[model samples]
Target: MSQQPAPRQGPIRRIAGDWHVIPGWLPVPDLGVLPVNAFLLAGPEPMLVDTGLAALSDAFVAALAARIDPADLRYIWLSHTDADHIGNLDRILDLAPNARVVTNFLGAGKMQLLGKGDPARLHLLQPGEVFEVGGHRLHQVRPPYYDAPETMGFFDPVDRAYFAADAFGALLPAEAASVDEIAAETLRDGLVGWSSVDAPWLAHMDQPTLGRMLSGLERLAPEHLLSGHLPDARGLAPLTSVIRHAYARGTTDAVPPETIRQIETLLTRS
Candidate 1:
């Protein structure tokens, strides 16, 4: 079996009002490092967006404790059942006894299958339901591309921030404190490379349909874009533009050959 790389935990930092990011990075061998982030909404009703990596459990729990007591958490928003997103679900649940997991029916079912989350503690949201907490109204958003059908992204009206489950994520050459630290071209290439691997369907998607979805997200005009595998982005335009231009004609040429090779390697390994 191939050895997995150890994930490095980053310091907790506040990205917006009452929004703190607990960041970590997983090296992807030759590709680069992928950011694994979990957000904390430190408000009257404290909520955690997603749990950090299980490999970094000690650091993750410590960073979380530094900001607020785990027992004070009111909600644990499960973006999806993906390991990277929910690695510390059970651990966090044990610590945050009062916190209910916010997810859709499908997500809850997946959790049950994994024997992780408690069904009684799940707060399932129906389609198109607005989750109101701590003076923030969160509207469910379906990202243009995703690896899992259960993925649930959201937009917070109060902070004008959009949490994109796995969309707009990029594999960077190094750990960046913020998106501004990376060069534009490098960021673009990284975004394309990561998306091509994570959501290969993007290359085969209908141009018009995909265009409409991206356009609608752009119309939302979110001031802050939070991604599970990216440093906090300042706005939605840049990320949306990268996806738009990459798939303008539904061709694979936009994706680098090396990225395709990497995908093939991953498939073979799987």
Candidate 2:
């Protein structure tokens, strides 16, 4: 008999040089809010990172248009075929007639299976291929863990920013303009908690292998770490550290009761 709260769009803000974030928040009944974000690279060759939530399609489009003309977009970098990431793919492709959907082979195939995207407009990338756009070279870097197999993260050489797709996402107690606003303890709890639910197989992953992947990202030393479900962050160290420590001995005993409750609530709602 009770109505659920609708997801709301947050103010659009710049993360760095030409990267702007279009943020939205989804309310979790007994838990806190989860941030859902899409990014825009307003440059000579404009590109969009994700399409944001379908529930906020109008607001997302309006927010994007305010920054750059939809038709001016050169590429739509889909992180994966997850609903939140590709919710507005069809709508965006329709609006951006000249734009191409930049994705991997599997990603393109997944789009076909969903009955979304135009084959003629797809720009598929081979593994280890670097995407060049607007004088920027985007090197594909797979995140340590992901809910979708087709997920593809990237690092921008121009801004030293790493877009980690769904990795490093957290469910915070409140909306934050930046990661600096959340307390260290809260961030750790939230990050580990969200990962447990998002990628449940993480607990079964080989410890040494996971550590090596995290180390590799740390060595990349991105100045800015961008995530789909968290506010803008400065570095990957803080996040990588939290994940490394949490899963050092596996996640079975690491997750807190509150996190379990939150996951249960989410399942029941769905």
Top candidate (lDDT): 2
**Could you tally the backbone clashes for each prediction?**
0, 0
Q: Can you tell me which runs of candidate 2 are displaced by over 4 Å? A: 252-270
Candidate 1 structure quality by residue, lDDT tens digits, 197-260: 7787887777787889998998888889889888988998888888888876554554567755
Clashes of 1: 0
lDDT of 2 by residue, 127-236 (tens): 98999998889999999989888899999988999999989999788888899999999999789878887877778878788899999999998999889988899999
C-alpha local distance difference test of each model:
0.85, 0.86
Q: Each prediction's Cα RMSD?
A: 3.1, 2.6
TM-score of 1: 0.92
lDDT of 1: 0.85
Scored against the true structure, residue 73 in model 2 reaches a CA lDDT of 95
What lDDT is reached at residue 104 by model 1?
A: 96
**Predicted candidate 2: what Cα RMSD to the true structure?**
2.6
- Candidate maximizing TM-score: 2
